[model samples]
Target: MIHIRFSDNNYGGEIDLSGTPGDLRSIRQSIIKLLQAQDVQVCIPANEVKPAPYDSCLNSLVIRKSDCSVKVMVAGSSLKIEGTPEKLKVFADWFNFGDSTESGYHNHFDYYEGNEWVDPASVSLIISCKYRGTK
Candidate 1:
């Protein structure tokens, strides 16, 4: 299963996929594609804004990936977004947020004479976003 979390205080999400290796790879690729489609960027805070100010601004998205999972974080000042989980889900689904299905396999025995083993298949994603205030 995969889980995603988003917060204004520190925007981020977590993905948990404990299953086949193929599924994990597919999911990872899907997430990368999704972010690319949204044109996500890495936000850098300005150097003049005060800390804990109440306002709205456009920030960038920071994405980090590993073997098991991937994480997405966004940072900025006065970052307040209006949207609940349901709303976000709707938007994600509409944009093909998590959709992928491609599988393949390799056999070492084909070349190693008698070496054969199955590779582990699964992926997880954890994302977090931190806002920095200006001086």
Candidate 2:
């Protein structure tokens, strides 16, 4: 099960997401709903027509806010993502929906280590927002 824990000053909850390797419609909906409830903007940066090998899908994301933070935990490892509200949302979306039927974007393959894929059951995420003023 994909478990996502979301926390902010006004809201805090957890969601268990259901889906499979190639499809993640439900996961996308749940995450987008959570971001919308937080009033965080969702943005996708333009991708290069010819991306280089090893290029990051989110490499062009710009940081507009210093207080907002999002983190993901896979297995026992923790990853912290820093950016504006939109970038953070983009990262979150990609983390859950990348390469799946729900996403129009290409595979970030973030869940893969080298040539192997990580088990979805061991994937969990924590999204924490500390936005001040209008995001």
Candidate with maximal TM-score: 2
Please, what are the lDDT tens digits per residue for candidate 1 over residues 11-128?
2222211223333333344444544554432222222222223222223222322222111223342111112223322223322222232222211101122322211221112221
lDDT of 2: 0.31
For model 1, where is the 10-residue window of minimal lDDT?
102-111
User: How many clashes in candidate 2?
Assistant: 0
Q: List model 2 lDDT by residue over 32-67, tens digit each.
A: 564566543322232222222212112122112224
Q: What is the C-alpha lDDT of each candidate?
A: 0.25, 0.31
Candidate 1: residue 58 lDDT (0-100): 27
Q: Candidate 1: where are CA atoms >4 Å away?
A: 1-16, 39-135
